[model samples]
Target chain A: MKIRVNGEGVQLKQPIQTVEELLHHLNLEKKSLIIEHNHIILKKDQHRESQVSDGDQFEIVHFVGGG
Target chain B: MLSDNRYHRQMLFEPIGEAGQRSIQESHVLIIGVGALGSSSSEMLVRAGVGKITLMDRDYVEESNLQRQQLFSEEDVKNQTPKVIAAKNRLQAINSHTIIEAKVIDVGVEELDSIAEEVDVIIDATDNFDTRLIINDICQKYRKPWVYGACVASYGVTFTVLPDETPCLQCLMDHIPNDGATCDTVGIISPAVQMVVAHQVTEVIKLLTDNQDALSGKLIAFDLWKNQQMELKVATLKDENCPSCSQAKYPNLEYQAQVKTAVLCGRNTVQIRAGTQKNFHFIQFKEHLKDLNLTNFFSNPYLVSFEIDPFRIVVFKDGRTLIHGTKNPQEAKKLYYRFVG
Candidate 1:
């Protein structure tokens, strides 16, 4: 499956069904992220249930600790 | 005529013509935190002729702050000037006609409520989410508008929250991300700070001049290093179950006994928050400290700090203290009680 992450194209060799799977595949800390799937923000609890399909766009914003 | 001539160029702009300029001159804005984003936004507001501004910050000016924070000088560092005081002096010099109020105290719910009621708009230039959330709660309760801006490294993000009209910060960010990457750790570029403030101040002007249609309702994010920009449409991001806007439950504001002792990200410093808000008289504290054989002691109207071997303790007027040279919250709390109590 291929999808766009932060405006970059990424190819997943294995099938990624949910937002949680994609985050896990990318080795990202789930707690330290604000994920937008298909232009809609997903609550942390919805990460596992939110489905990710081919050609989907994801924006994962990391909060930085500064003024 | 001379007073009006000062803003002649801004008056020429059709959007902010003489009437809009007058509106700008009649507005009041409160800015929290005088760090990078705060300093830049405050400078722009003063130059733009905002009638009055109240600056609230607890930190002092350090040499490291000179790089991105524009409203400070080497003298501020040498004097250990509080950020609000230094910013007020610089902003006043820039526009003496504009009223600048500096408060060197931590802004919790009680302080925010009174200040929010007095100001037309608020700017979130704070470093932490805790303060931002409190701002959101108070702004929502008062039906005031505020601009939220944050920057770290080469990236920055901003959003404007108009009470009762748009989603508050709590509506957009259900959970606060504790990523622990601060400018003190990852480093910040000057341009990133400029870009964030540019957007924030522009929104502020639009709101003040009654140009509500011109305000960007979406969340704006930019990364100068990566050359990426994003406009996340947060118009429909309001959660019905939000504790702030929906349920009208302000946990952040109501939780007053918050004894927050946490290690500042990447600074090797621990902030020992005041268990309760108290008025700390700096002069009295300084006078009492004269008997103690403490070296390198400094006293200002806003705060007082003393060097105790490897540790340096800075006690603010609000009783909150920042303990440098240690990351342990327990150690910071111990020092706070021993020295401050």
Candidate 2:
């Protein structure tokens, strides 16, 4: 399955069921992460239950500290 | 009317035409942190005819700040001038017509609550989420707009918060500790500061002039070195039960009111403020400092500064001590208790 992440296309060998699975597949730490799926932000608790599909758009924002 | 042709070029920009320029001239902004982003954005706002600017910063200028903190100079470092004072001096030279209020006080919730009330807008030039979260809550509680900006290494991120109309910082990030990337951990470049400043200043102007349609209602993050960028629409991120916006709880304000310790952003410095007000000056600690065999030290009426190997310590008149060389609060507090206490 293929999906877009931060404006880039990514292909997954195994299908990802939810945002949580996608993050696990990509090896991204869920801490300090704000995920936007289809232009909607999913609360951290909601990520596990939220599902993802092919061609779905995702914007993963990693918060940084500095001025 | 403070009529002047100095802003004639800015008046030509249709979005901020003659009326908008006048509105900009009448708008007041409070900028916390006189570091790189704060210095750059304040300069732009002043140049764009911002009427009044209040700058709040706790630390003084240092040699290392010259690279990216634009307004500071060698003289500022040599004199150990506070960041707000140095920036105020340069900003006044840039536009004498704009009123620049310089504050060299450590910003806490109480300080911010009162100061944030007096300004039309606030700018987040700070390097830590501790203060940013406080500013977010205060702005939300009062319904004042604020533009949040942060940068580290070669990357930067920015977002604007309009109280009732949009989601807030708390609504976006669920964690207290950020991604842990800081200028202290990985050194920063000038472009990262400028890029973030560009977005922040643009939002400040748009908010001040009531250019609502022109506002970028998206969260922008970019990595200049990696050639990566993201502008994500975050309007839908607003949580119905958001503590800051929806319920209007303003949690940070109450939580950080009595808090004293803070890590100076990107400086590897930790600041600890005394619980109660106490008079402190160089003369009071001169003999004690000498007894410690610290011959390498300097004392001024305002602050007593000394160096002990890796750390440079500055103790202010208000019993506020800034220990430069460590970001750990406990470590800094240990050093403070050993010497300044």
Candidate 3:
């Protein structure tokens, strides 16, 4: 299955079912991330239950600490 | 009847005509963190004739700060001037009519609460999320407005929170990203700072001048290096379970365990906070250091710094110490306990 992450296409060998699993698959589960999946901003609580299917588009942004 | 021509060009901008200029002249702004974004926003506000600006910062000037921070100079670095002092000196010269109050102290929830009541708006020039979250709590509690601005490397993000009218920082950012990249690790560009400050100042002016319609309710983020810009419409992003805005509870502000030791971003330095607020007599501390045969030390009314081989520790009158040359919090805590405790 393939999905788009931050405008880049990513090929997933295994089915990444949920947003939590997708983040873990991408090694971003521990990182601070704001996700916009298919043009809707998903709250932190929704990441666990939110499902990601094939051809899904995700926009992820990580906040940086600097002034 | 207005005599000052210094802001004539700014007044001529139509949107900020004489009436708006008068509002700007009568408004007070509190800017926390006199680092990169703080220095730039303060200067812009002062030049545009903001009536009063209270500048707060905990750090002092260093040579590395000259690359991006705009207000300090070589003399400031040579004198080891605190960031707020240097910024006040430069900002006053920019517009002496504008009142610039400089405070060289760490601003916590209590400090912010007292100061927020006196100012029309608060500007986030702080480098850390802890401080920003605290500001969000105080601003929301008091129904005051504040502008949030931050930058690292070539990327920047900004948003304006208008009390109950807009979404707060905690509403958008539920968890502070611990693995976030900092300027100390990635390096920052001057233009990124400029762009972030520009957006922040614009929002501030709009708020102060009563141009509420002109304010952008979205969270703006941009990367100059990548030529990418994003405006997230966060007007509906307010979280009902948000601890700061929704529940009217402020965890960051009410946090009792003050951080004893913190690794400063990019500076390879650790800040060891005093257990309690002590008015450490500078003269007494200096004598104590001298008695210990610590020859390499410098003293001023505000602080005392001594060199200990690879580590240089700067102790403030309030008992906080900044230990340079290490990033490990445990090692910094050990040094603070061994030397200052």
Candidate 4:
């Protein structure tokens, strides 16, 4: 299934079911990540329960250190 | 004293009209860490005619900083002028009317408390999480608004935290853990710093000019090289149990009471503020250095820079020592104690 990540479309190898799984696939599960799935802020607890579908947009951001 | 028509072009803008210009002129902004972001944002604030700008930075100017740090020059690097002093010197030249204050001390909880409450807004121009978290905690305690911004490589991110209204940095701290690249590791471009500064200074203008409603409530991010931009809405990110904003328990403030030692992110420098040496005699210390056979060193009115092979130790009047050539706080502490003790 193809899912939009940060405005770019990416295809999942398997049918990824949840936001937590997507984070795992992206190897960012352990990261302190704030995910916006379908334009909604998904809390950390909701990552496990929130389901992802094909063509859904996600905006993921984490703080970068510098200045 | 602002000359009439000095800010005529800026006053022409609709939002910051004559009244807003006066508001801008009457405002006082405290910017921490006069690095790329600090120098750039402070410049915009100064040019926009902010009444008073107090710049705080511990590090001195280096040749590497001139690429993005707009205020410094070869002369500043030659003299090893502190970042805040160099930035203030340039800022004062741009607009003689604006009051540019410079503090060369390393920022800690005690330093923040002394000035945070008085400023209209605080800009996070620091390069490390420890400093930013401290700024976050202190801003929460004083109930003052602060703009959070960071950039590395070709990417930048920023958000404004309005104490009670928005999710403070502590609330988002866990989610935004320190795992990204740094300027020293991946290197940084001028555009990344400029992008973040644009947002930071804009937030400052909105806060000062009574246009708080126009402030961007989203977490703005940019990847200049990849041409990516994201403004993530973070209303739900506010943790009600946050010790910083919710509980009025500023745990970061307690840090000042402890022994202060921190790695100045990516700078290959460690600052150790072990104890206060109220009456530090530079001439006596220079004589002491000579006795120890430490030959390569320089001393100015502000600090004594001593080089002992790999490490260049800069001793301040108050026993604060910046040990360059090592990033280890423990090593820095060891060297500091060996010398200062």
Candidate 5:
């Protein structure tokens, strides 16, 4: 299966069933990102219940602290 | 009528030609949260000839607000008027052709759908992240474009959230920062607010005049005191799965988030929030404080204050207040009940 991450295409071997599983599989900390799938925002807590399918687009953002 | 040469400068810009001028006159902009950035942005917007503007602010003018909030003056503080009303009056006087409506109330999720759907664009001049998140959610739901602007200490950041195209604030950061640093902890400078809001106002003009292609895809951050500027690229994150833009769901608009206010360091004050109690009285409430040797320092529909012993009990009419001379919330609440009844 293939997923587009932050506009870049990447191939994945494991069939990630949900966004929560994908984040867990990718070792991505949910707290560090604002996750949006197909123009919709998913709360960090809801990632557990939210499922991800083939060709799902994700925008993951991390905040940097500075002046 | 503007002279041919007078209009020539702006008309030559191509985007602000006669056609765009028509759109500018016809467009209605709602600015939620009129504080430092809000007052500056709205003032410039009104002077720039935005046809209709509705300013929503829950705070009143104060000696502190006068430093960075441009529209207010010392006389405004003496009059004890709400910041929104005061800003409106000044803006109307600046350009009578522009219609100014002042709504002295907090912008809640319930009012989001009606208000966001009505305005051509909403500007995020709010101080806190919670309200900014709410504005983003509402704008996303209605597909209304809104420019995000914030300033804390000497640092400022801004971005535009256009639905179905660019990224929303939530698309960039999902959870509200529990440990997010605020101006209260640090100190903010006047020039920082001016520079940040100027960028936001310029972006607002660009968006309103239908020049969306020129919009930048990076989060703009700047520091005047330190003389530093950086534009962190948000373009790559645009493709990341954002719940607000990708899934078509908005959570911040679903409920009233917890409220917590803070004090700006280097400033002699603390912020108190009491949710949505609208009818907090000052004159009658001042009668309760007769026993104390406190003087009525400031009073208005938005705020009231009396000097009590070692501190100032500045009671905002919105039920929120700042008990200057203390940083503890419990102490502030104790003072709130002692004199507010």
Candidate 6:
């Protein structure tokens, strides 16, 4: 199935059961990305418990150190 | 013999005549960081005729602040008053006609986007660079114009950022210098603050009056003590490569400020921002802490500090408090509620 990330379309590799599984699959760190699934913020602690489906859209943001 | 004569002197300026005065009457401005620049800018905006002004500061007025923060008096210092409250009181007295809303809280990144959109223009008076960058990102995301001003030692800088219409502060400093040489570290001069705030308020007035043509096209820097000025042209820098200006990604909104749980810079103290209650009154709170073996609990007007258990709860008349114990938010919140509550 396909999903949208930050308004861009993307194909899901497999049915990801939870945010933790997706992060492991994408090789993304919680510290590096500010994840918002369907407009609601997910705290790092809750990410492991929250589930993401095949067609779930998410926005991942990260901050770069700049003046 | 006319009633509007109080503002007659300014009305004669043509640019801020009756129509401009009306605009000022209807406009609302949010001032972030009520320190040197925040204090002065809030004072000017209130006295001029801004319909409503929101003054937010995370710190309280200290004895040292009296020299540069013009609105604060010795009485305010004696009271250990919070800067936002003190500034609001003084501004109100100056012009009872305008409404001054004072909030004593850190302008966290998560809150910036909505706050920026609520006000007509955001005025930067904060001393730190991280906060300024957060403000820049939010303003750009909301397409809200904000006036930027800063002063370090004798040097002062001011610029009006109209989001996509001009280059934002990030276009100038891609990465902020995390050095320890801030006003609190090195010290600052009063004249420099005045000059910087004066230029800032002027730009705000120009922007509010729709005199967009007179708006500055470059980043303006000045040395008040040495009598020097530098205007760097940065118009070309406003391009698609800029994340805030071009990509339109608002980082502040995306990321809630890192849980705001940390030990203060001084290992001896840990500062905890209020989690649920955005507002905390130290005066009424001190009574509860009286039971603790507080080294002191002197509270008449501005400041309140007391020692409890393994830490000290030093709360400025403003809502900011320093918990001199573990940097852990859980511990700090427990201590704050036990004593201050």
What TM-score would chain B receive for each of the candidates shown?
0.95, 0.91, 0.95, 0.94, 0.83, 0.86
Lowest lDDT 10-mer window, candidate 5 chain B? B257-266
Q: Please write out the lDDT profile of model 3 over residues B66-140, one tens digit for every residue.
A: 998999999988778999999999999888889989999887876787788888999999999888989989998
Model 5, CA-based lDDT: 0.72
TM-score of 2: 0.90
| Candidate 1 per-residue C-alpha lDDT over B127-155 given as tens digits, one digit per residue, 9 for 90 to 100 | 98988989999988888999988888999
RMSD of 6: 13.8
Clash pairs detected, candidate 3: B184-B266
Better of 3 and 6 by lDDT: 3
> Which 10-residue window of candidate 4 chain B scores lowest in summed lDDT?
B172-181
| Tens-place lDDT digits, model 2, residues B42-66 | 8999988899999998778889899
- Individual DockQ of the candidates? 0.51, 0.62, 0.51, 0.69, 0.07, 0.02
Which candidate, 1 or 6, has the higher lDDT?
1
Better of 2 and 3 by DockQ: 2
Clashing pairs in 4: none
For model 1 the local lDDT of residue B62 reads 96
Report chain A TM-scores, every model.
0.89, 0.88, 0.93, 0.90, 0.81, 0.77
Task: Tell me how far the alpha carbon of residue B43 in candidate 3 is from the true structure, in angstroms, after superposition.
Answer: 0.8
Off by over 4 Å in 5: A1-67, B1-8, B174-185, B224-228, B239-241, B257-294
Could you tell me every candidate's TM-score relative to the true structure? Answer: 0.93, 0.90, 0.91, 0.94, 0.73, 0.73
- Using TM-score as the measure, what is the rank order of every candidate, best first? 4, 1, 3, 2, 6, 5
Query: Which runs in model 3 stand beyond 4 Å of their true positions?
Result: A1-18, A21-27, A48-57, B1-4, B257-259, B291-295, B328-334, B337-339
Off by over 4 Å in 2: A11-15, A38-40, B1-3, B256-259, B263-268, B281-293, B300-302, B325-331
Please, what are the lDDT tens digits per residue for candidate 5 over residues B1-341? 55344345666777778877667778999998888888888888876778899888866777877777889999888787788988988888878888888887666786566777779999888876767878887887888988888777776778888888776787677555544445556657888888878888878888888887778766776666756565655555563566666777786767463554565333455666655555666556656555565576654545667787778877765566667787676676677667663
